[model samples]
Target: MADNLRGTSGPCPACGHVVAFDASTSTDMSVETVEEAQNVPISFTRPEMPEEVMDMTPMVDVVFQLLIFFMMTAAFSLQKALEMPPSDNQEKTAQAQTLEELENESDFVIVRIDRDNNITVDGEDAPSDQELLNKLREAKLGQLGQGVPGRTGLLVLADPQCRHETVVKALDAGNAVGMERIRLATVEDTAF
Candidate 1:
């Protein structure tokens, strides 16, 4: 009978009896009349709630670190530029010459680089870099005998499809042979 009435709080079905319980106290129950149970007062309590919070210190620190890294690695200014003298106003400056005019000049030693990246000196094929350097040295010495010490110029005529490294190598070879005056010319494309 007690098991069946464990959680019940109304009048008993078998008899006209009222039962009351105090959960704060022991399991011992109390029997009362309906009128007496109605006269008793009941109390309730609200449940407690937890507080919510968020921390942003670590996130702010990481953002500042990234900003500092980028600021330190960024390029802010350019390096120094080369210094050149201003042009003379009194002297009459000559106009630029065409490729044909330059080619016709007898003082220039023509060095041609074909589309196949082959270096040729005065229209003759140079087998290797050493051979080309020797030929350039001999030409410079020969030009010296003609009253042109540093006046003998080197004109490099290169095909458009030739590699830039090959042109640089040719320039280096010319410099190695003590050729002071060097000029570059780009050949017109005939594919169109």
Candidate 2:
């Protein structure tokens, strides 16, 4: 039988701590009754709230504006194109002051026109201007493979006092054999 006390004592269901209940009424209730009352189910659901959406139009507009700004600031073309002859392997030949005497000059055939308009190839004097032009033509057509990319060409060194006519002749010889690359030697400290 249950005690006739008007209040009851028991462990709290929520905190597990000892709790006391009033039992001052006409009948007394047991600790088990209070424990059972405390064990009733409780719902723990949050209140419903409306969902939110973010706008992306402003972010996309900013990206497009940045793209346009970069495109407008970029360079479109080069102002000048430098046309320079290919540099020969420097180690293969001993460098000479003039193109005519380059040691171990196996590829390039030098054409040096002196102040007196005398022409020489590899230190050997040419009999005449016509002979030098002929040798250049032959080298271009057969040995140098003129008109082809990477084909070797003539390195002409015209003395400062050489006539313009001599330079024109040398250029003509180069053009005749389809040799487009012509390198000229210039003395240091000479005014342009």
The clash numbers for all candidates, in the given order, read 0, 4
Give lDDT tens digits, candidate 2, residues 1-192.
134323555565666766555555434333334445466443446988878778899999999999999999998984433245576687677454544354235456667778777776545566666776667766655543333223356676778887888766776666665566566674322321
Lowest-scoring 10 consecutive residues by lDDT in candidate 2?
142-151
Task: Compare the candidates by TM-score and give the number of the best one.
Answer: 1
RMSD of each: 9.4, 16.5
- Candidate 2 local lDDT, residue 168: 68
**Alpha-carbon deviation at 68 in model 1, angstroms:** 31
Query: Can you give the lDDT of residue 160 in candidate 1?
Result: 93
Task: State the weakest 10-residue window (summed lDDT) of model 1.
Answer: 143-152
Per-residue alpha-carbon lDDT of model 1 for 51-102, expressed as tens digits? Answer: 6676899999999999999999999985433223366787678588888887
Model 2 regions lying over 4 Å from their true place: 1-105, 127-129, 141-151, 187-192
